[model samples]
Target: MTPPPLAADTHPPTELARVEFTALTGERVERIAPISQGWGHLSWTVRTTSGRYLIKTGIRRPQQADLYRQVAAQQIAAGSGVATPIVVAVGTPDGPLQRPCYVQTWIEGADAASVLPRLGPQENDRYASALGRQVAAVHRIPGPRFAEDCAATTTYPTWQAACLSRIGRLAASIEEKAVLPPAVLYAVADRLKTLTDQLGNGIVPRLTHRDLYLPNTLITGEPAGAALLDWEAAAFYDPVWDFVKLGMWVFEPHPALRAPFMAGYTEFEPLPDGFHERLTLYQGIEYLAAFPYFGSAWPDERMLASFRTLLSGWMDAHGLVGARP
Candidate 1:
């Protein structure tokens, strides 16, 4: 089976080997950093004779092969006033570049996640507002059908199956690494099954980032420029999935995270009915249940601290703890 390519597969991409400069664009590839933690297509930054641009190219072939995702994102961002990387050039991988490529204006500065935790409460709130408004802009993009084009966005029916298959992998990782007790594994499995059951009960779908945590958001304070990049896993699904994932990652049911995210998301106040329960459902089902699967790989303090935070947040949100000796 072919694995997905790094998203935005392009010359000078962060992951793929940088390619030779071509005449089509004057930009020169200056520095490159493998966009780790990103998927589907590889992306990189290029410093040209003119200016910097974020270039992405396609990867090893998949059914949704080519550059539709880039086009769709650029179109959506442009129409909605979202601060997206400006679409520059879209083309087939130039000869040596077997994959398709796309060029967009580079976003300077850092990802918002980097500075979020350190900011003062006011900064945090302001940034959250920026993010909310930015996300709302993208979500507002009009698509005849709101659901993601699976092939275009690196998702498929296989994705749901992969999550299910993760159950055994989670248990094996726990047993292999001995991170937690056997009972804990069983408990996680039980909770996951219940959570997955809620996936499509009402079919009230909305465009979702699917992975809209802080890391993916780029921010500036003056005008507060914010952009949501990397649309590989984005799809039309329960909109709450995005917000809940944000809460889970930021503080694990910490209402602080939800407050601004939800606020900026709407022009007027929108009630997130059953918001807490919905929030808990996603994390308990998604993050907590999947934690054991990574036990073998992410065993250090970073991993430990993250889970400790998760546990604290989970317990605080819903009075549930397992096998605490």
Candidate 2:
């Protein structure tokens, strides 16, 4: 007998995922429910008779290769003893959903973003340290080439070139959105270009979880260990980019995590030279990008306002708010 289709509201055809899961594991699916949905992806927590699993799929047709890359990165991290989810199956959905999807072992944990604020100082530091070590391990693995996406085959000759290209794209995006005034936008573009030029060449691209942040980290275990989630944004790029992301998304917000995290990272690898300068440039780019990147859906108005204030102070600190290119 044909099973009743999964809920219509569960986008990307959770029914297909259920069928695929059953076929793969020979386990009867008992229940499935959407757990998270955003950024063009929908995730469902599926409970089988024996266990639970996570099925993540995009709302639109996904690049099959990209899905593979995501799984590959996750597997690599897992192999390195990092606590990433184990992949069970991945492929294009053979249904109306059309998007690529993957099923993996479900982890019972709270998002570090929500959990960190409530933790005691010692516990927070421990999780932060664990996260740092995990990040360092990921960086130890080399990538295919210098590109933003793990699945990207394109290569850039120099780190500066790759960085400038990315900055250009961000500038163009913000300009298109008209998030900032024309004068301010032009100056900011020039400042970014100047900063990008300062980044020298011969940097090797390393595997990086480009979206590492408290929200993307899952804290599990009795004492609460940290595990990375969401490998969709993994990439081959300067490791400094990951540091910049962590600085903005983690350290800046939760200042206490900074010292322990940095300490843990240095356990495997010392902080890269010129790290602070690179961080400043990258932070400026990210702060500006946040406007269009988060859009109206930004959950925290206070945070958004903080970014504006931060951006203004950043430009002033660099003494380039209206400086020429």
Candidate 3:
């Protein structure tokens, strides 16, 4: 059986705000469902008098609105043929009216997470391969504009230095949360050395989405086409880095989706020589460095668990810790 569309009322906002926003957009904000309110912003969907649209507003951490990230996202989205919300409004230093808020067309569909559970073994593999191919397409985007992270993504001049800098950032955030196992902190640092020892010299760099999680990819009506959204992390880097992030959640590489996705990837880029080995290293480095991005303020249990699990995977690849064999 098919799953029902995500109920529109997932996160309804206040009635008064709805009236005001309606006047603001010049379209009746019939239903304003709050989506997620993160660090400095809140997102709500407006079933307007005319059509459906998404409205994201900046709150406490309002400065994020003016960042160059949207510019990067706009460029990438244009090249990738993906769906993205255009910047509708941005705030000034004054207040809410001046704060950054975006409104764009609301796509009616489900994310990969919702559809994954319903797929058959073969279907899952097919979708994975499709995802892999799409990722390849995203990597091939041409531009020298994102040179800053490009070199870093290709190969580390000094992996140890890079690793330390990364861990220092994450550790700051980890410390803010509940007591983290001292071993986990130490283990995160120690594993970096092990991965660095095996690091290869040169790597290919390309424009990478940086964060292409399942939920970020949208599947549209009946014939279901894939569309990647959320470009806040867009930058030039090893395209493989995108795949590493997408695949990390799979414990053993999902029983259904692993092979086809890899095969599909090879068709486009011929998978980097020693792709598996390098990808493993990239995954570990990326996982540890990302801890703070997600766990900085929120001491969420799940976030910490994911942090450990990612580390464990890293250890498995390098024998960084005492033998698990």
Candidate 4:
């Protein structure tokens, strides 16, 4: 989805004072700059006497438990040797800050999305390989049941059921919002049903970084590797979903990086059987589901037309054709 336009780097005086006092904890607040890229949250890069930190305040206050769960997931990934931000403090609505917020030690680096495209071929390959290795490390951590670990209300005994439930929710949202044409939705729904049927049983769930795209990864010189950011979407899911995301958001658009990333990933864990087919199915599902998010942000007819073109490409790749009901 195209990112929303950045809001000005201004904060209400009262909120700023409260956040500074609460998060800084007696340290002097040097600077507070708005992070304009991400969706659904207001983030600031805060500089203080102690160190630089990231202050993330929800655009709408999230459930307090959900905020805490995100912190827990970040801690778990960091513990597993993944380079994730350390949660510093959390603020609640009852606190001085009205909105739910968390502060974390900010890792200094350029966003991989910008850095990777500008690098020499060798360096680009190196960075992609590093990212793949880091991702694999995160997946190795054992966790509670998929739903319970993430504090999701629903639970499913099988991966297929959970996936279908998620897709169904996305489809419902798209339909209710009138995000895409009925023909496109019908084709995607049909393909997803067939794909679900083809999924094998006994799939084991692992901790997945559900949104592992280039923008969420940081490239640093000190550590000389890729660090993952934004653990809010972390959950217990089929490991294939992570690979699917990597392919869709990174490798598919930048094919040169693919071989190195796969090399690093397979070095740690070998690809399972029928990986390509499963990845393709997931790509289609992900693109279709993403319409609700993108449509809500960019509601223009041109954006809708772009969505249709992308969906058509996905359907064609999967040998599915749209038919109006």
Candidate 5:
């Protein structure tokens, strides 16, 4: 996968972050160190008299409300028995600090991506299974009766309808950008319409951690479990979409990892019929939908080429070559 461009650090300086941290938590910061793995947020591991905590700020303005919402989502996930970090305190958007921020208890494990490759076959499977079960647990949370609008003011009758509507908007955005070639854009439009027709309605909606790839999970020993991080992208949507993302980003590329995750998830909920076809449809939509955002973030030739290559491969695999609206 092409790496996302590193967002410039718009966060306050460490001393300033420390001052705000002290003001919010009422404890002096003993140490502050940056966490380098993330791309979108500026975060630091902060040690204080109370405990070790994570201090995170958005890389851009207008992120305060979103940060607050993310904290709420993490609380919901934790309440559902998922091993997520607890939110300690949150700074208001209009406060003197101006930047919205939050403090959460620090988790103590390396990301799964870093640890998975070092483990033996048995250990890897064990980790994957644990991760799968946690994902299933999150999916068990009941979704809202009404679909959530992007602007947070309206609702749709069904999750599928809401998703199709969103994809339609995304299709228009991508076409306007013209980042993708005409052939690819035409193929994407054809697939989107077909998926909308075939997917239909009345599927039960569930809480989906839309960004639950390998790096977003932390692996630990002894207890042998995974702690999911980054609840910012959590939403109410089709649970199958999460499985498709996991298969594409986590399991499929690494053959040895596939069976264990499936074994764990199937233990909780069985895969529905026509799973592969649905998975293909969702994957295609994801690639196309992602193009606009990723293209805007990283506009260099190499990144665009990488995206084109991925889209071309998906088209070939799905027999979508020469497919046009």
Candidate 6:
């Protein structure tokens, strides 16, 4: 998969970010530069008189509760022995940022995406394994309920309910956009309804990174020393939901490392029965959701052709060719 353009020339440092960083850390800012920014948040690498920190403010108004939850998620990951940036402060930003923001101690590392291609076979395997173990450690932390968003009040009582809510929302978006063929959308949605029960019986609500892939990970010090980034999307859900991103976006693109990564994850929790089926179900839903999310952001033919390939492959794998749209 093509990498998103780096936030090199964009997301220039703003006075609001600088002001908020100073207010949170109580240190005079010596230097501040943009790290990266995406749909949800704007991030910067800051050096203060006392120390360096990562200051991230939302692109628009993010819920104050979600801000607290992001901090909670980061703290939970750190407690699980996962290397996330340490949170310093989290709260409502004064202005211009237009939302709640947080500060974290800056970690020194190169993005795992940039570093992976440079490694030898052994080094790649070792890094993937280390990352797997770290992810599994975080999954061991349990939550009170299953939620897509991190807000406590919005959580669903059952894993099935949460899964259905996610599926319903994505299906609605795709229908509204009318980008995907109705037949393709209906077939996946129907198959999901039949298979959603599989998720119900064995799944447990655990803290999930929600977004975990090479781009969100950092290789620090050594390839073995890694850190998971971007906890704003973190939530309490089935761990396999996280693997949808890891397997499809990460492992599928880098097939050679999938085994080592799983080897490390299975060290913590063995793969459950019907793991492949559950993964396939989530992946189909993810592909459907991408239409609404990426339809405008990505070029039309590129997006449609990619989806046709992915969905066609999925349908073919499950003997749905006779049912293909």
Best by lDDT: 6
- Give the TM-score of each candidate: 0.63, 0.84, 0.69, 0.85, 0.87, 0.87
| lDDT at residue 130 of model 6 (Cα atoms) | 81
Tell me the tens digit of each residue's lDDT in model 2 across 150-184.
76656686778887888788778777876667677
Decide which is better by TM-score, 1 or 3: 3
What local lDDT score does residue 295 receive in model 1, on the 0 to 100 scale? 55
**What lDDT is reached at residue 221 by model 3?**
45
How do the residues 125-197 of candidate 5 rate in per-residue lDDT, one tens digit apiece? 8888888788888878877643441123345677567767777777788778876666768777677667767
In model 1, the number of clashes is 17
lDDT of each: 0.57, 0.75, 0.57, 0.73, 0.73, 0.76
What is candidate 6's lDDT per residue for 1-325, written digit by digit as tens? 1112323345634676787777766787888887563555678878877788887765532566657778888887887778788898774634444447788987788788988999899878888888888888888888888876555657888988887888888888778888777787887887887778666476778888878888888877763467788887788987877888897679889998899988988998787677788788888887777787667444466766677688788878767645443
**In model 5, which runs have C-alpha deviations exceeding 4 angstroms?**
1-11, 60-62, 93-97, 146-154, 222-224, 300-303, 321-325
Tell me the tens digit of each residue's lDDT in model 4 across 1-325. 1122324443434447445545546566777776766754568777777898887765432566657767878888887788888887877656555556788888878899987778999888888888888888887876566553455545678777877887788788888988777777877887787898898875677788888889899987646488898877778877787876786679889999899888887888788777777777777777786677667844556655655666778777777765421
Q: What total of clashing residue pairs does each candidate reach? A: 17, 0, 6, 0, 0, 0
How are the candidates ranked when ordered by TM-score, highest leading? 5, 6, 4, 2, 3, 1
Model 4, stretches more than 4 Å misplaced?
1-31, 60-66, 222-224, 297-306
Where is the poorest 10-residue window by lDDT in model 1? 150-159
Native-referenced Cα lDDT, model 3? 0.57
- Residue 287, candidate 5: C-alpha displacement in angstroms: 0.7
Instruction: Evaluate model 1: give its lDDT.
Output: 0.57
Task: Give all candidate RMSDs, comma-separated.
Answer: 6.2, 4.7, 7.2, 4.1, 4.1, 4.4
- What would the C-alpha RMSD of candidate 3 be, to one decimal place? 7.2
